[model samples]
Target: EPEVTQTPSHQVTQMGQEVILRCVPISNHLYFYWYRQILGQKVEFLVSFYNNEISEKSEIFDDQFSVERPDGSNFTLKIRSTKLEDSAMYFCASSEWTGELFFGEGSRLTVL
Candidate 1:
Protein backbone atom coordinates (compact mmCIF):
# COMPACT_ATOMS: atom_id res chain seq x y z
CA GLU A 1 0.00 0.00 0.00
CA PRO A 2 1.15 3.53 -0.70
CA GLU A 3 1.45 6.07 2.11
CA VAL A 4 2.88 9.52 2.78
CA THR A 5 6.26 9.67 4.51
CA GLN A 6 7.99 12.52 6.33
CA THR A 7 11.60 12.94 7.37
CA PRO A 8 13.30 13.98 10.63
CA SER A 9 10.22 12.96 12.58
CA HIS A 10 11.39 15.40 15.25
CA GLN A 11 13.07 18.75 14.67
CA VAL A 12 14.33 21.28 17.20
CA THR A 13 15.43 24.77 16.25
CA GLN A 14 16.03 28.12 17.88
CA MET A 15 13.70 31.04 17.42
CA GLY A 16 14.72 33.14 14.38
CA GLN A 17 16.27 30.11 12.72
CA GLU A 18 15.03 28.42 9.56
CA VAL A 19 13.51 24.97 9.24
CA ILE A 20 12.45 22.83 6.30
CA LEU A 21 10.14 19.84 6.59
CA ARG A 22 10.02 17.25 3.85
CA CYS A 23 7.35 14.87 2.64
CA VAL A 24 6.84 12.21 -0.02
CA PRO A 25 3.25 11.41 -0.83
CA ILE A 26 1.75 8.36 -2.44
CA SER A 27 3.25 7.98 -5.89
CA ASN A 28 0.06 8.30 -7.89
CA HIS A 29 -1.78 10.88 -5.85
CA LEU A 30 -2.52 14.25 -7.38
CA TYR A 31 -2.98 16.62 -4.43
CA PHE A 32 -0.69 17.39 -1.51
CA TYR A 33 -1.22 19.46 1.59
CA TRP A 34 0.38 20.64 4.82
CA TYR A 35 -1.55 20.82 8.04
CA ARG A 36 -0.41 21.53 11.58
CA GLN A 37 -1.51 21.04 15.15
CA ILE A 38 -0.19 23.22 17.93
CA LEU A 39 0.08 21.16 21.08
CA GLY A 40 -3.39 20.45 22.47
CA GLN A 41 -4.98 22.53 19.74
CA LYS A 42 -7.15 21.60 16.81
CA VAL A 43 -5.54 20.69 13.51
CA GLU A 44 -5.44 23.57 11.10
CA PHE A 45 -5.01 23.72 7.36
CA LEU A 46 -1.91 25.49 6.15
CA VAL A 47 -1.73 25.03 2.41
CA SER A 48 -2.62 22.78 -0.47
CA PHE A 49 -0.58 22.18 -3.60
CA TYR A 50 -1.72 20.67 -6.86
CA ASN A 51 -0.36 20.69 -10.38
CA ASN A 52 2.80 22.25 -8.95
CA GLU A 53 0.93 25.34 -7.83
CA ILE A 54 -0.76 26.42 -4.64
CA SER A 55 -4.39 25.46 -4.92
CA GLU A 56 -5.42 26.93 -1.57
CA LYS A 57 -3.86 28.42 1.54
CA SER A 58 -5.00 29.48 4.95
CA GLU A 59 -4.25 32.73 6.76
CA ILE A 60 -1.51 30.95 8.63
CA PHE A 61 0.57 30.67 5.45
CA ASP A 62 1.85 34.15 5.65
CA ASP A 63 5.11 35.53 4.23
CA GLN A 64 7.19 33.50 6.65
CA PHE A 65 6.22 30.21 5.08
CA SER A 66 6.67 28.69 1.64
CA VAL A 67 5.96 25.38 -0.02
CA GLU A 68 7.80 23.78 -2.90
CA ARG A 69 7.96 20.69 -4.96
CA PRO A 70 11.65 20.52 -5.75
CA ASP A 71 11.02 17.41 -7.78
CA GLY A 72 8.07 15.26 -8.73
CA SER A 73 8.56 12.91 -5.78
CA ASN A 74 9.29 15.27 -2.93
CA PHE A 75 7.43 18.19 -1.38
CA THR A 76 8.88 20.60 1.16
CA LEU A 77 7.77 23.35 3.51
CA LYS A 78 10.23 26.02 4.60
CA ILE A 79 9.83 28.36 7.51
CA ARG A 80 12.11 31.33 7.03
CA SER A 81 12.16 32.54 10.64
CA THR A 82 11.01 30.29 13.41
CA LYS A 83 9.01 31.51 16.38
CA LEU A 84 8.02 29.98 19.73
CA GLU A 85 4.49 29.66 18.45
CA ASP A 86 5.75 27.69 15.47
CA SER A 87 6.26 24.65 17.63
CA ALA A 88 3.79 22.04 16.49
CA MET A 89 3.27 18.75 14.69
CA TYR A 90 3.18 19.21 10.93
CA PHE A 91 1.42 16.63 8.85
CA CYS A 92 1.79 15.93 5.14
CA ALA A 93 -1.07 14.46 3.21
CA SER A 94 -2.12 13.45 -0.28
CA SER A 95 -5.27 12.18 -1.90
CA GLU A 96 -6.62 11.04 -5.20
CA TRP A 97 -9.51 13.40 -4.67
CA THR A 98 -10.42 16.18 -2.32
CA GLY A 99 -11.86 15.24 1.10
CA GLU A 100 -10.16 11.85 1.24
CA LEU A 101 -6.77 12.47 2.79
CA PHE A 102 -3.98 10.01 3.37
CA PHE A 103 -1.59 11.37 5.98
CA GLY A 104 1.99 10.83 6.97
CA GLU A 105 3.30 10.32 10.46
CA GLY A 106 3.73 13.92 11.61
CA SER A 107 7.01 15.81 11.87
CA ARG A 108 7.23 17.52 15.23
CA LEU A 109 8.88 20.95 15.27
CA THR A 110 10.01 22.60 18.47
CA VAL A 111 11.35 26.13 18.59
CA LEU A 112 13.06 27.60 21.64
Candidate 2:
Protein backbone atom coordinates (compact mmCIF):
# COMPACT_ATOMS: atom_id res chain seq x y z
CA GLU A 1 0.00 0.00 0.00
CA PRO A 2 1.73 3.15 -1.17
CA GLU A 3 0.75 6.60 0.08
CA VAL A 4 1.71 10.24 -0.20
CA THR A 5 4.22 11.49 2.34
CA GLN A 6 4.90 15.06 3.38
CA THR A 7 7.76 16.63 5.30
CA PRO A 8 7.96 19.13 8.15
CA SER A 9 4.64 17.97 9.54
CA HIS A 10 4.55 21.22 11.52
CA GLN A 11 6.28 24.49 10.73
CA VAL A 12 6.23 27.82 12.50
CA THR A 13 7.54 30.80 10.56
CA GLN A 14 7.42 34.54 10.79
CA MET A 15 5.37 36.63 8.43
CA GLY A 16 7.14 37.47 5.18
CA GLN A 17 9.43 34.49 5.60
CA GLU A 18 9.86 31.73 3.05
CA VAL A 19 8.69 28.15 3.47
CA ILE A 20 9.00 25.05 1.35
CA LEU A 21 6.76 22.04 1.81
CA ARG A 22 7.78 18.72 0.36
CA CYS A 23 5.84 15.67 -0.69
CA VAL A 24 6.35 12.31 -2.32
CA PRO A 25 3.30 10.97 -4.07
CA ILE A 26 2.48 7.38 -4.71
CA SER A 27 5.00 5.99 -7.19
CA ASN A 28 2.42 4.99 -9.77
CA HIS A 29 0.14 7.99 -9.61
CA LEU A 30 0.22 10.44 -12.49
CA TYR A 31 -1.48 13.58 -11.27
CA PHE A 32 -0.47 15.53 -8.18
CA TYR A 33 -1.93 18.48 -6.36
CA TRP A 34 -1.37 20.86 -3.47
CA TYR A 35 -4.43 21.75 -1.42
CA ARG A 36 -4.82 23.71 1.77
CA GLN A 37 -7.32 24.10 4.58
CA ILE A 38 -7.28 27.30 6.58
CA LEU A 39 -8.18 26.65 10.25
CA GLY A 40 -11.92 26.11 9.96
CA GLN A 41 -12.51 26.69 6.28
CA LYS A 42 -13.16 24.33 3.45
CA VAL A 43 -10.34 22.69 1.54
CA GLU A 44 -9.00 24.91 -1.20
CA PHE A 45 -7.11 23.84 -4.25
CA LEU A 46 -3.86 25.55 -4.89
CA VAL A 47 -2.23 23.86 -7.86
CA SER A 48 -2.07 20.71 -9.86
CA PHE A 49 0.77 19.19 -11.84
CA TYR A 50 0.93 16.49 -14.43
CA ASN A 51 3.34 15.39 -17.14
CA ASN A 52 5.98 17.62 -15.52
CA GLU A 53 3.96 20.76 -16.13
CA ILE A 54 1.33 22.73 -14.24
CA SER A 55 -2.04 21.43 -15.29
CA GLU A 56 -4.15 23.96 -13.42
CA LYS A 57 -4.04 26.43 -10.57
CA SER A 58 -6.47 28.33 -8.44
CA GLU A 59 -6.50 32.09 -7.87
CA ILE A 60 -5.30 31.50 -4.36
CA PHE A 61 -2.06 30.29 -5.89
CA ASP A 62 -0.68 33.72 -6.48
CA ASP A 63 2.78 34.79 -7.55
CA GLN A 64 4.00 34.11 -4.07
CA PHE A 65 3.65 30.41 -4.59
CA SER A 66 5.45 27.96 -6.84
CA VAL A 67 5.42 24.24 -7.43
CA GLU A 68 8.10 21.97 -8.81
CA ARG A 69 9.15 18.44 -9.33
CA PRO A 70 12.83 18.89 -8.75
CA ASP A 71 13.43 15.20 -9.17
CA GLY A 72 11.64 12.09 -10.31
CA SER A 73 9.93 11.36 -7.02
CA ASN A 74 9.93 14.60 -5.11
CA PHE A 75 7.25 17.25 -5.55
CA THR A 76 7.44 20.51 -3.67
CA LEU A 77 5.58 23.75 -3.01
CA LYS A 78 7.48 26.89 -2.11
CA ILE A 79 5.91 29.96 -0.61
CA ARG A 80 8.09 32.96 -1.42
CA SER A 81 6.64 34.93 1.45
CA THR A 82 4.45 33.81 4.27
CA LYS A 83 1.56 35.90 5.56
CA LEU A 84 -0.37 35.67 8.81
CA GLU A 85 -3.37 34.48 6.82
CA ASP A 86 -1.25 31.83 5.14
CA SER A 87 -1.44 29.58 8.13
CA ALA A 88 -3.07 26.33 7.10
CA MET A 89 -2.67 22.60 6.72
CA TYR A 90 -1.21 21.89 3.31
CA PHE A 91 -2.02 18.52 1.87
CA CYS A 92 -0.28 16.73 -0.96
CA ALA A 93 -2.43 14.41 -3.00
CA SER A 94 -2.12 12.20 -6.03
CA SER A 95 -4.30 10.02 -8.22
CA GLU A 96 -4.13 7.89 -11.31
CA TRP A 97 -6.07 10.25 -13.56
CA THR A 98 -8.24 12.28 -11.25
CA GLY A 99 -10.08 9.37 -9.80
CA GLU A 100 -9.36 8.74 -6.15
CA LEU A 101 -6.82 11.02 -4.52
CA PHE A 102 -4.42 9.63 -2.01
CA PHE A 103 -3.39 12.27 0.46
CA GLY A 104 -0.55 12.75 2.88
CA GLU A 105 -0.87 13.55 6.56
CA GLY A 106 -0.38 17.19 5.60
CA SER A 107 2.20 19.79 6.64
CA ARG A 108 0.83 22.40 8.99
CA LEU A 109 2.16 25.92 8.44
CA THR A 110 1.74 28.47 11.16
CA VAL A 111 2.81 32.00 10.47
CA LEU A 112 3.08 34.66 13.13
TM-score of each: 0.98, 0.98
Encode model 2's per-residue lDDT on 13-58: one tens digit a residue: 9999999999999999999999999999999999999999999999
**Stretches of candidate 1 above 4 Å error?**
none
Model 2: residue 80 alpha-carbon error in angstroms = 0.2
Q: Write the per-residue lDDT of candidate 1 for residues 2-73, one digit (tens) a residue.
A: 889998799999999999999999999999999999999999999999999999999999999999999899
- Supply the global lDDT for candidate 2: 0.96
- Model 1 clash tally, residue pairs: 0
Residue 73 displacement (Å), model 2: 0.5
Provide the overall lDDT of each model, using Cα atoms, as 2-decimal numbers: 0.97, 0.96
Instruction: Find the 10 residues in a row with the least total lDDT in model 2.
Output: 94-103
Error of 2 at 85 (Å): 0.8
